[model samples]
Target: MNEQIHEKLKEIKQSFRLMMNGVASHSMREKWVAYKINWGVPIPDLQKMAAEYGKDYELAIELWKEEIRECQVLATLIMPAEKMDEDLVEVWMERLRTQEMAEMLAFNLLQHLDFAPALAYKWIASDRDMYQLCGYQLLARLFARGMEPNERGINEFLDQAHTTLEGNNLPLKHAAYNCVLSFCELGDEFDVIAQKALADLNIL
Candidate 1:
């Protein structure tokens, strides 16, 4: 089973390399490659592949390490988001541990699943660059997805966002601004909470 997964990953890597010749490095070709490959594929394909291997996460983790950047990105799509083990997710998270990417993933996952607040809170308070963005991204996605924002959660995230803005770090500031903008699209229920949060932060 490991051999089969390894071979399959090799084929994917070869195909990805062939596809990359036309992709400009200045653009986000890796993400595009991952999106194209995973889109429209049945989730069962991943399940079947994992099942054949006895659902060995160690094998999956090893396979993720074998690939280059785009391959790792593509590998994440094969793991069922809901069934992802805590340890395996942590392992994969470490592999893609950029602040922006971490934040981006928190937002992306919220679109498909409920907020794992404990997992998210670690990133929210992280002093690292991308990890902090992960927190704001989670908050923005919660509002953007219209998922009944918890008042306490909103207040907590706003506190973090305000801190981010005060840092004078351009990347964090931009992420915060985008998060605020995304939050604005929510109607009155969230608006009322956001208005109060912002006032408390003196962002109003």
Candidate 2:
């Protein structure tokens, strides 16, 4: 890393240390978060920090490589969407280790990307749980924003969501459920379609 990024890393880690919560960190561990270093910094605090740091692609990439939960979350918040090309996104996806990271990236970063729809669709088709969770979460954000997918997209989404909801992964099911709910929010037509699609799963 360059001197400037190294200095910034030191500063960010120091800030994370100052805001750390043992209780939150313990809870996350109990839930199997598995981050090598988790400061237990809350999302609101991370957002404040991101605003202070502003967007710097290099800094975000370095932060993400830290293996610290707070830094990764901060990376998602402060990353420049335009600079996060497909290859970079795949690299990050390969590094994803937990559902928390998936949700954090989906909520704070991927949702804003111009190619998020295609990305979400691609991930949902993956057999990996984390990928599916991220996909569903990203789709939920898009749905909440009232974005409409074309017929093929809707079909693909419904198939993946139904498969996920029917599976045993609670996190993926919940994420898929949220997507369905937000998809319903698009309109009554979407509502009917989603309801019919996942009715057997007992979620609308």
Candidate 3:
């Protein structure tokens, strides 16, 4: 990395140290076992840092590689969604080790990508827990933004969600439920599918 980027990373680390809360970090670590490095900086603080740093894809990539949870969150915030693509998204998804990271990537980064809808479908169909959660979360974000999938896409998603719900994984089931809820809000056309999915999952 260049001197500028190196200095910026240093500055961010310094800021993290200054703002870090030991009690909160311990609490967060207890909740998120996947986060080995928890600085315990709040989201608002991270947002302030992101605003100061602006969008720097390169810097964001570097920050994302760090083990620190807050750094990873900042990375998503600093990354320009327009600069995101399938390959990078795949790489980042593979790095996600916690539901918190999955949700951050889904809502803060993945949801803003041009390929979000397509990618959401792909991830939701995956057998991996984190990938599926990210996919469902992304779908919910898209739904909140008033984006609706076609009939075929809807069917495919609901089918996958049903399968996930049938499984014994609580996290995946939660994601599937959230995805179904988002779909149900789209229109009456999806009501039957949603109800069927909920009923099949014993959530009705």
Candidate 4:
């Protein structure tokens, strides 16, 4: 299994070299996106690669262990969400280093977990900005899928969001704003609550 995975990883790395975009890679570096190696493959191309390779748990795990930006994004795309557990999720989250990775993980994998709501709630309360960003992005994904929070959940999410919006992290603010928009999409009930929250923030 290890040998096969290594072989597969070698092939993937070769593919990355073939598809690499120097301009895009430079852009990511200019934006301060740090990774040990960034092949500069765009997400759409990675998506195509993922579809071609299909989901492979071992392969995804191996890809994620690499510090390459494209590898991590591909890991998120090809990993089986159902196979993810809280501990594995935490381990993966700890390795996150950029907003790009956070968004990719949230959109492609995190939101599909059985305990996605729990992950969102737990991460939103963290002092780490990346965790908060991932939390909000995951929340946005869930909400976009028509998930609604209970009264308690609403209060918790709004409380964290209120604090997050008032902070200095522009990326987190954008994520939280999108999350609120998604929650508001649930219906008139959620919309009213979100409006009230926005008004309290003097954002209305």
The pairs that clash in candidate 1 are 99-130, 99-131, 103-134
Over the stretch 1-204, how does candidate 2's per-residue lDDT look in tens digits?
Answer: 999999999998998888999999999999998999998888898899899999999999999988899989999988999999999999999889999999999999999999999999999999888888899999999999989999999999999888888888888888888888899999999999988887887764
**10 residues in a row with least lDDT, candidate 1:** 33-42
Q: Which candidate would rank higher by lDDT, 2 or 3? A: 2
lDDT of 3 by residue, 1-204 (tens): 888988989898888988998898888767755676788888898999899889999999989988889989999999999998888887787788888888899888988888889888998998788888899999989987879888799789878888888889888888888878888888887777788655845674
Q: Name model 2 segments beyond 4 Å from true.
A: none
For each candidate in the order shown, give its overall lDDT on alpha carbons: 0.57, 0.91, 0.86, 0.91
Q: What is the C-alpha RMSD of each candidate to the true structure, in Å?
A: 6.1, 1.1, 1.3, 1.1
- Clash totals for all models, in order? 3, 0, 0, 0
Candidate 4 wrongly placed segments (more than 4 Å): none
- The C-alpha TM-scores of every prediction are 0.70, 0.96, 0.95, 0.96
lDDT over C-alpha atoms for residue 158 of model 3: 79
Q: Write the per-residue lDDT of candidate 4 for residues 46-98, one digit (tens) a residue.
A: 99999998989999999999999888999999999889888889889889999
Candidate with the larger TM-score of 3 and 4: 4
RMSD of 3: 1.3
lDDT of model 2 at position 183: 92
Instruction: Please give, for residues 171-194, the per-residue lDDT of candidate 1 as tens digits.
Output: 678778677767667777666666
